[model samples]
Target: MLHLENLSFSVHNNGDSKQIISDINLDIKRGKLYGITGPNGGGKTTLAKVIMGILTHTAGHIYLDGEDISDKNITERANLGIAYAFQQPPRFKGLTVEDLVKIAQPKLSNLSVRKRMRDVGLCPEDYLDRDMGSGLSGGEMKRIEILQVLARNAKLAIFDEPEAGVDLWTIQRLVDIIVGKYQNNPEAAAVLITHNRNILPICDEIVVIEEGRIKHHGHRDEIWPIIRDDIVCQVQDTCRGEEII
Candidate 1:
């Protein structure tokens, strides 16, 4: 559903260019969920942002369904069936949960909107009318973040650390929602930027991005040992409580 060709992004600081992502050639197929993980400052989030047009690529082309969207802006990409859920969700002081839901999917009935909230482990009575600002916890805001993304029903969804601050119940529901999105749709796919072990095993493919480039990319079973390595699980987050770090 999405193709990234020779993609690269760099930033200029003190007249020196520092590369964040370089020569990332990837094909994200429809009906598949891709898991992306790596160390900090590894360009994972930057690559995702570049795809969403939040950051302009220094070089290379981004194609969605065979059309070049490299030059498109954030709104344009979103309108073209792309959705992104941030690692750190944004704050909107005045907008209630219902308001944001309406903005994402105006056609959803009030009942449907509330149902989505419940799907994310949020109680409608307590959160439907609550402000999306300081009053809401990080986990709450993250749930709402995924809620809006899921509401868009985008062809390609990019989730940057969707499991960051949520409880187990919400994470489980999130896995269900994400996996269900492209399971039967031949035209939908997802890119998950995460380290949660609960999410990695189910992915059709796993990608490891390190030092501004893809270090390893392959089927899950082929790369599981490479990721686990020795003691530590190598992954930062705890995984199934068996050999958690």
Candidate 2:
């Protein structure tokens, strides 16, 4: 289990300190998926980075399975079975998909690599030898990055915007793979930060953050109705803008 006790973060913007995350408290248990969704600039990503130790919290404690990890660095946290997937995955000019996977888990075998590719809905022969560069589209790169995290077999995984820039079919496949693999592991947990409505359906619980505070959080069935209405409003606004253009 992962626990955040009154976690908070602040940063210097224009030489003035501004709080990005308020006194946020959350508990994440293994075998469950926790979805974080909200409008942009709501500190959702900041919270994930704090949990991953990418940014040191100004106050509060972070505990993993009863161990105090609040002061640990990003590498230390990763060594403790915590993994994070970036919103925009980085590209490696000379690295093949197989090579990257090997680096993630040196003990992974050729057969396992093929299986991982297939798990993410990619054909082994078609992607294993492909370079992790511009040749791969945003969606392909996201899937490959996810495959690397899966190979790590981390106890807790944080994925930021996993469905961004992907088509509906691809998003569906990715969400299924993520929820299936992560939620099925009795000793692992997943935290997904996304604005995609489709991904929310698979979550065990949803946390809605607004203006650096948690506006609402509860079981999927309980929270969906309120959030669904908000999402509908946003979509309608977007459509209106498109029509105007």
lDDT of each: 0.90, 0.90
RMSD of each: 4.2, 2.4
Give the C-alpha lDDT of model 2: 0.90
Candidate 2 per-residue C-alpha lDDT over 119-167 given as tens digits, one digit per residue, 9 for 90 to 100: 7878998998899876998888988888888889899999999888777
**Each prediction's TM-score versus the true structure:** 0.93, 0.90
For model 1, residues 94-166, the per-residue Cα lDDT tens digits are 8999999999999999999989999999999999999986789999999999999999999999899999988
Model 1 ranges off by over 4 Å: 230-245
Query: Can you list the residue pairs that collide in candidate 2?
Result: none
Which stretches of model 2 miss by more than 4 angstroms? 233-245
